[model samples]
Target: MKILISWLGKTDIDHMQVDKLAAIATLATKHTAPFDTVLILANAWEEHWHDYEKWLNKRLAVISRPAEVEVRQQSLSSPIDYVAIAAVMLRNLQALCQGDNQVYINLTSGTPAMTAMSVLIGQGMYQCHFLQAAPDNSVVEVRIPLDFAATYKKAVSTSVRNKVIAGPSLSSEFSRIAAESDAMKAALNKAAKLAATDLPALILGETGTGKELLATAIHAAGNRSAKPLKTINCGALPENLVDSILFGHVKGAFTGANNDHAGLFEQADGGTLFLDEVGELTPAVQVKLLRALQQGEITRVGDSKTRQVDVRVIAATHRQLATMVAEGTFREDLFYRIAVGVIELPPLRHRTADIPDLVKQIMAEINAVFSKQPDYKSKKISSSAIKFIATQPWPGNIRALWNALNRAVLWADNTELTVTDIQNATVDAVKTDESSPVVPEFVAGFDIQQYIDGIKENIVKAALDKTGGNKSKAAKLLGLANHQTLANWMKNLGIAEQ
Candidate 1:
């Protein structure tokens, strides 16, 4: 049940029948090595493989024992046909080759390109042994060194092929949003394939899984790319404002209403509307959304008129809508309406193989952002730094990875980001969490400067409230130089005077 996949070299070459030498070496091996069969890959030059098979069988018969034999004719199209060959080998070997049977590839024959491909498939994916029909009448076994980077070469190769075939710009966007993991590739390709249809798509992924990004890509890849794509975060809005924000509100529609506002649907009239975290919508909002999906119309708050709109919808959620449906929290009809197409994104931990690419990607963008500031300095990451990062269990997925790298970019000074730099960045996050008034989960991903500015704005507002809205008293309570300084701080933070 042993097998050796060897190429049938051209008869015009000096190595007219490479399989014969390979067979002799296999028979002469130290242990009774289980090299009992051969699978030959041949091209058009092998017009009389039957005669060669007869010759090969005669040569093999002279050995201690006979082996099963077969030859598959193939059409050569490119110099690097190994990609397709490796793909086929991956599919078939897993299905057919297993158990006590041993496998090897005879790389001593064929074109240099073919031999190199054999080595790649053997070492990269199959972990198969290498057999060389040594001219000295001995067998040469090639063993590849083992390492974390070396072990993941097969996965890396697949990712490279996917990126190459996916085109430069399209693959760039997809990888930026959801690196080249097998799961993400499947989900992403499915989204793109189905993007043209008008059916509603439901994207499922955990927090920081790039649901919003994927939704946007699907919209652009579809027929609606030419039109506006309005997006809203359902989770951030309160139950009362969901209706008004999504379906429009007239002037004086409520107590504080001052002017008419077009909702997402109206704004996206002939395009697509993306609802991020759709599972977080209140039951009332869900009912209204269901009505809109089923009836192709939306009614403004406090207005009885229902206006017809032709807006395609793409809903995404990190939560389990099925569980909510079972719990009677989400409408079953709404769930079905939005579930016309479903794509589940894998978490970052599952796609650790894609981390290196993500590191390069996020770092490039981080550098671009850094170049915008006079005080901020751009940073590059070391290969070891990337390796150290890939070893971590990124529970927060891509967002957490980016957040850590963002800090590292700011922390590193005139040096490439190292393992210690990344560790320091994460350590700082831990310290920030311990001293925060709120829970770490709530503040984990907030930008440091933005968070500080928000705290300053809140404190200023609180001081003014306690001082009867008097700028002078607020400044006095805060020990500022004058009311003008307090006013300037407020203006800088974009907080209007009360």
Candidate 2:
């Protein structure tokens, strides 16, 4: 397959940006060899055309298949004047669309004109693939046929709905750490299915939801299981270091480069590279990444030689990638590529049924850890303690559960753990109000009717807040006997209609 990379250029090329693009081209040649060619289209003004071409040529020479690399520069009177330049490039790409060869387009670092041209070309070239650069400076390739605009639109709409309704999928690598819940099981099953395929998978979920676990599991189950499982936390790295870490660097490539280093791509050859928190990658990194994914090759920093590597990638994140893409924080083409098979993990609160089993397992594990002797001691968990644990909201999910159990085990002076132990340990950690205010000892002659009314009002208010002031929904949530009762209470309490 032949892939074309077209990007618009300003009067001057950023040295780092040029190097990154060169790295991508090298990587692509390695992956899609013998049939692929990269076409770089840049606009130049009269003053900088010669300098730009010289710089571009020097960078392009570092690519493995320099012969297959084509650089086209159109001249304009001024750098800012791109109207005619864009028109010509678009017309040329449109002409190239009629060819029988399969073409994939990279728009990750393309100028606005190039992006527009890509969209237009995409509409006409049904066989073309769209690749975008991700925030981590990786390439994300997407296959959207020209005739499937309607389908693409529908899919995007559904994806948005899923995000709103279900949130992000949990990381497959972190699945083992999550509590046993139906939602967790469903997420695991979905992850397993996606693991069987080679397509790029996007995992979404809130922080501490074990997204990395899911990614690891998927990688372990895949064909690359025997190879190294490399992981990069996109959010943890600085912008300048991301490319060097991911694509490697030659000796003396930068100030910190004491020796030549192979990047994650080379390390993960015939294995898996797990990108965690991928939403945090910068646009420059995204462009390079898009090129690498499209071509499947990479070059070391400060070197022109190219090498091919086979690596399956699984990316995880808690942020909304789609929203980021829409807001220009993420590349749209990259989003489409990584989201081929998306899986969402539900929060702990939604699956309360599995809490008992989870608690039992956690308690056993905690007991084993706490015992100094190698011998395992059987400890009984009080029924009241179990009941309390089940009722309390676990915002931190399974991690919180494990920590709570560890604390309980530490405080358990005997073989039995009571409700007080679990409550004290967990309630404080979860920031729950544990003190019951003593209740004034509940005098026997207290006004019972007034007390009931006050209790009812509090419950109504809590329910209303939980349901966002939707009276009918609040009535159902609060388990009020009927709508009329809720209405009566609302009127009596002087609660105006919301």
Candidate 3:
């Protein structure tokens, strides 16, 4: 059975009321193949669906088509509620996409969120053909490239399944992570699947992007849940004690080695070992780390014999290891080993839709801490305050957002925090921290050009997202000379235009 599925939009309703050709109408009349059933999803008032179905039936009859019309209400908390939209898409697809049923998804007749969800779910999870109707009354099949389609299918299918099983995404270890954007959800979906195996996983993201939190979650959800999950910050490890700390040492092995100490690899035996900022490891340490990962064994600093240890390594770094490999800093062999199950976490700015939920969670934690104070006074943030906070570029990611919220709550002298409070908080957050303005630490092997290009990529992408991919508007936002300048920069930076 061939079926066409679409969401009822305001423009679609208006066109039907005026007896003009709507997006769905155009699809039905112009598409080469005829649909056996036309399923219309409506999420508006009750009366809207009734009138829409009536007009839809009349139009189909006028066209002399015998397609059956079915209208169903797809409830949502709001037009842009990504969680609700994903769940609805999953349920509908699970029901309609049975064996031998050909499904056609109309990406032309709905809100941007609706259309996006349809594309992601339809193209990624199911064998559904997609159609988009332009204002010219022409309908075209939306084709996704093969490689991306396969990845999209895997990531999106996992996301939908996790959301469905968790029932509102609140119970499971993966569900507890608050997220509303597709980027974060996709990352989480990949993480959950990686958790099921003992493969070495690499998580890449900016600092304060919750790499450690994700590593811990993967450990807790994996088969090694009963064993110890040891964590070590390679960046903070003492240069002299790096070998002793990682592979352990026997008594009298070194000047300070008075006792036989077990290192992290030994301690994390039969479980997972999280290597935070793995890119910071020195060249010598990388060889030993790679040995342990490949041989499943390690030798003490002064010991000639190697002892077996079962450990799954989950390494994370803000640095681009591939760049390091090209520069001959990080080992290429180790890179491929840990990158078997790589997951790149999107920075907080890219997943701004999650800010509100993160705010709520942070506020609850703050309120709980404040309740213990003698002169505690809990505060609520106004919607405008949230909107204002969401507009800024949080270069520091979640950690930055948390600090800003904390500052706002502490400095604001009111029960309810307003936009002014948020604005003041942001200004104060950027003020000079000591003698001069604060500066980020430049570590060894830091690529200044790569860093600059990263900032440009982020800013350009944010502008494009804000302007709905309009080159002219995005150029204006970035203070560029013109859209042509923006285009040149985008091409140079490899920032693809959607």
Question: For residues 1-498, could you state the per-residue lDDT of candidate 2 as single tens digits?
Answer: 465656644412453344444323433443344335666666543454455445555554556344355566654444343444445555566666665766666665545655665666565445466766555545666655446567678898997798679955545444454446767677777876677678788898877566776788888777677889999998887778877888899999889899999999989987888889999888888888877777778888899876666778888888999899889999998888778888886655676766777778777777666676554465778877777677656767667877888887777776788876775576445332223232635777988677656666666765564444678877876677777789899888767766
Candidate that scores best on lDDT: 3
Candidate 3, residues 1-498, lDDT tens digits: the string is 889999877888788778888888888777888788889888885676777777777877877876888789776868887756877787798899998999999998878998888888887789889998988989998886655576768998997898679774222777768779999999998898888789899999998899998999999988899999999999898878888888999988989888988899999988989999999999988887888888777889888756667789999999999999999999999999899999999998799898888888888887787789888799888887787677766778888888878888888889898876766666534422123213545899977787677667766876675565899988986799899999999999998877
TM-score, every prediction: 0.51, 0.52, 0.54
For all the candidates, what are their Cα RMSDs to the real structure?
A: 22.5, 17.7, 27.5
Which residues of candidate 1, in runs, are more than 4 Å off?
Answer: 1-178, 375-377, 428-498
lDDT of 1: 0.73
lDDT of each: 0.73, 0.68, 0.84
lDDT by residue (tens digit), candidate 1, 328-443: 99899999998989999898878877888888889889889878998666678999888778766565778888999988888778559987788667542322222346642456
> How well does candidate 1 match the true structure in TM-score terms?
0.51
Candidate 2 — which residues are off by over 4 angstroms? 1-181, 372-380, 431-498
TM-score of 3: 0.54
- Which is better, 2 or 3, measured by TM-score? 3
Give the worst 10-residue stretch by lDDT in candidate 1.
427-436
